[model samples]
Target: MAEIRIENLHRRFGDFVAVRDSNLTIRNGDFFVLLGPSGCGKTTTLRMIAGLEIPTSGRILLDGEDVTFLRASHRDIAFVFQLFALYPHMNVGQNLAFPLKSQGTPRAEVKARVAEVARLLRIEHLLHSPVGRLAGGDRQRVALGRAIIRRPKAFLMDEPLGTLDAEFRDLMREELRQLHERIGATTVYVTHDQIEAMSMADQIAVMDKGVILQAGPPNEVYRRPATMFVAGFIGSPAMNFLPVTGPVAAGAQTIAVNGAHVTMPKLHEPLNHDRGVLGARPEHMELADAASFRGRVFGVEYLGARQLVTVDTSVGRVKVRAANTGKAKAGDTVGIDFRSEALVLFDGRTERALASDLMNGAPVEGRRAAHG
Candidate 1:
């Protein structure tokens, strides 16, 4: 196990800056995930750490030793790409033993290691099967086994499960998590799928446009995003944002959504000088019997245990998650409530969070008077 640290990392291509000055510390045996959309520099960051791509300016440290200039073969890292890069002509046993063979391990040891990894991955029965004969999931497992056989200081995975079917992907996710627990190897996984990041990572780094917006546990980033981009990016159904114009209240501010007044929780930082945007997740917004705002249900989607209803309000269209009791339908008049505890305020101009204090449930002072 090894700790990975990046200091003032920057990557550029001529005049284009692929990655900005980024700093991060990945603890020993930590399963760190770099998550973002495509072209967000996540792959570039992973490659730099793997010694496959050199950073324009920065230092990378593994186990407290600087390895920024180390060659890929000397970095002591295992890289698993999205595509299963197995040799088609080789069987599973031969494929797994290839790495040890290249390193000149004794024949007996190579055979033992191959058997051990194949059994660990439940692929021992398929050891003699050709790489082309294995299913997609099996091939992926073989690729992972090959990477693990070398026992590198860290494992770097770049969307290794992107090509698998949904069911296989889900199964592999649990398998991967269990494998990490068993080995406790330091790992840095890169993916655009937020669900995978949320389920598999010990810590998640949310990135956008060559910059990391926030890095923390999954719940922290979801409940209290540091920026509007994160609030919208980290969740499914995303987060809903509404523009409001009003003075900050004494204890808290209230936004006039259409004619309905919705009180906002106090922010730790003053937000009176700039316009405030209200953000709430779909689960936090609900149709209730005695909600403050009234709206008409525009659509209802049945999703197993819960139903998602789209409500057209005077403020805007908002989505609400409710029990699938089959009680709500389109064109029904409904009262909508925003859970104050889950609400977040942002600067309308800059789109950054108004206060980190909101994350910790602290009460903030109001900087302006309320308006009716």
Candidate 2:
């Protein structure tokens, strides 16, 4: 296993900056994920790590060895692309052995390695099947098996399950998690699917517009986002941002949001900004009979055990996820409540989180609960 470190990483296409000055440290045996929307430079970053794309200015270190100029063939890393890039003419066993054959391994060792990987991936029975005849899931397994048969130092996967159906994708996610546990290889996965990153990664890097916004454990980045962009991008329905006019109190102690007085939380560093916005996730906000803000329900969607209600409030339309209580309806005036602890304040113009300021007591004016 090897730890991958990147420093001052940058990539540019003429005047267009594909990646900014990014730095990250991927520990050994970590199932790290790069998650973001399309064209967010996630793929470009992954390709750079795989030696497929050269960085404009940066240094890549593998286990303390500089490999910034290494070619893909000499990097001792395995990559599985979105498509299952298997040769149609070769059978599963042949495909799995091709890598070892190219490296000129002994015939006995190549056969043994192929059998071992096929059995580990549960594809032993289909080892002789032609690539075109196997199902999508089987093909994907074969592709993975081929990559692992080489026993590379690290594995890089780029949305390897994007072609599978929803059900197959879900199953593959669990399978990949189990596979990672068994092998414990240092792996870096890139995907736009937040669910995959949330469930599988030990650490997740949230990216946007070629820059990494936040990096931490999945829940930390979800519950306490470092920036407004992270708060708006990581969740399912996404966090809601509301504009509020407020005054900057002494020591940044308090702020008024749309006539509602709220106390600020204490911060490690002082924030010297005035105008800011409040952010809350759908799960953090609750519907109450007598609350501060009032809104009309635009629609309600029943999602098995939970229901998602869209409300047109005085501020704006906000989505609230609640239990399936069968009480709320469309076109009804409902009150909304949120825990002060769960609320996130950000600078409206810069979109950066504000520093906390409350001394010892509860920061804001609501019940407190750990989110997520």
Candidate 3:
């Protein structure tokens, strides 16, 4: 296993830029993910790393040696695609042995390696199965088996489980994570699915418009998003943004929203925007009688252990996650309160987070109920 370093990476197709000055260090034996929506250059970045696509500019270092211009075959990195790219004529065993065989690895060694890989992936029983007839999950396992069989310096997977059904994707997710643990190989995975990135990555780089928006561990990225796009992209229900009339000065502890003054963390830097946004995850809000932010319940969604209550506030509609309280109903007026530390303030013009208590690690003040 080896560290993969991408420095000032940029790729261009004619006049359009696909990746822009991307700088990232994928640690040795780390499960690093490039997460973003479609056309966000994640696959292009992964391809650049795999040596399948050369960068228009920038450097790619594999364990300190520059391999920016190396051929895909010369770089010892294995790439697994969304579509299981397997030989239709070969059996699973043959597919697994082909890389070694192509490298002129002796027959005895190829056989030994194929058997080892099959056992590791628990696909020994399907070794003789035709690749064309395997189930989606089984084909994915074989695809993975083929990648790992080479014992490459690193693994690059481009949505390897994208083609699987939801339930099987979940199953494969767990299996893939376990396999990574056993091998401890450096892996770079690209996906548009936040669930996959959050569940499997040791580190995540959130990208947009060919640029990286934020990068960190899953929890850190979720807790302290550097940009509004990131705050909205990472969570399921997404963060709720309440409009704030701004030009707010530094050190202010309150902001005006819909003619009501709401208590918030003192800002360390002034927001120069004519308007700003107060971001809070649904789970951070509570129903309190004395709270300043008031709204009328408009919709209530029962979600097993929790209920998502939609409220039409003075500013806009807001969703609050609370315990399955049968009490909330449409048209019921309620006061919405939130934890001060959990709030993220964004400059409306730039859509970037402002320095506040969120960045200072202030303890959360209050939540309606502990369980949600």
Candidate 4:
């Protein structure tokens, strides 16, 4: 187990930049996730950490030792790929023993380690099964088992569950989280899926356009995003951005959106841009009958215990998560309102989040809840 620190990490190829001025810290014995959409430089970042890809400029320190130019084989890290990269001809036990054998451990030690890993993963019955004949989930378990058998300083996983089906992926997600907790291994995982990042990561670094936009615990990133891209990328159905149409001064408690004055928490600073956007999550909004801001419901999606209701407002269309009681349907006019503490004002010009009491994690007392 070790702490991995990345400093001023930058990577370039020919005329294009793949990663830019990135700095991060993966704490010892923590499950850290690099999260973003496809080609957001998460994989490139992970490769650099694993010593598989060299950074154009920066430093990589593992366990307080500089390993910026170390070879992948000498970094003492195990990598697990999305597609299970198992030796097709080898049986499960043999695959698990290969790492120890390659490192020239005694034959008895290799056998003992193979047994330990199989039991730990609860795949003892499949130790003799051929890798080519195993199910997807079983094969993935074998891949993880092989990595775990190595006893590496840390584990670098690149979307290890990306190839599984939806239900299987969900199951594997839980399994992987539990495995990480039991082993207490330092793991750096890369994924484009927000659900996986939110549910599994102890810390998440949200990236976009080859840059780290925000990094924090899941709840902190979800509740208080650092930028418009983070707010929009980290949530399902995403955050709603309504255009601000009036001048907003420091400590202001209200703003005009489409001619209606919507109440918000007082701002910590004056708006830097003439135009701005108000951000609110779907679950934080409520449908009320008398709220000054109103909209027409045009879409209602059933989602098991909840429904995602889309309303067309004068400013923009907004999504609200409501109880699936069949009370909301298409073509209904509803008043839209949210808790003042849930709003995040962003500078439309820079697309950066503005500071506020709530955004700064202040506890404001006696705030009203949204309801219809």
Q: How far out, in Å, is residue 195 in model 3?
A: 0.5
The order by descending TM-score is: 4, 3, 1, 2
Which pairs clash inside model 4?
none
| Evaluation by TM-score, superior candidate among 2 and 3 | 3
Question: What digit string (tens of lDDT, one per residue) describes model 3 on residues 117-191?
Answer: 999999999989899999999999999988998999999999999989999999999999999999999999999
TM-score of each: 0.93, 0.92, 0.94, 0.95
Q: List per-prediction Cα lDDT, in the order shown.
A: 0.85, 0.84, 0.88, 0.88
* Comparison by lDDT, 1 against 4, better one: 4
lDDT of 2 by residue, 95-178 (tens): 999999998999999999998998899998998899999988999999999899999999999999999999999999999999
- Give lDDT tens digits, candidate 4, residues 1-372: 899999999999898888999988889999999999998999999999999999999999999999999999999999999988899889999899988888899999998889889988889999999989988999999999989998999999999999999988999999999999899999999999999999999999988878988887898789887788999998988999999975689889888887778788888778855698999999988888887888889999999999999999877799999878888789999987887877888889888777778755442111110000
Best by lDDT: 3
Off by over 4 Å in 3: 359-372
Which residue pairs clash within candidate 2?
Answer: 265-356, 265-357, 265-358, 266-356, 266-357, 266-358, 267-356
Candidate 1: residue pairs that collide: none
Clashes of each: 0, 7, 0, 0
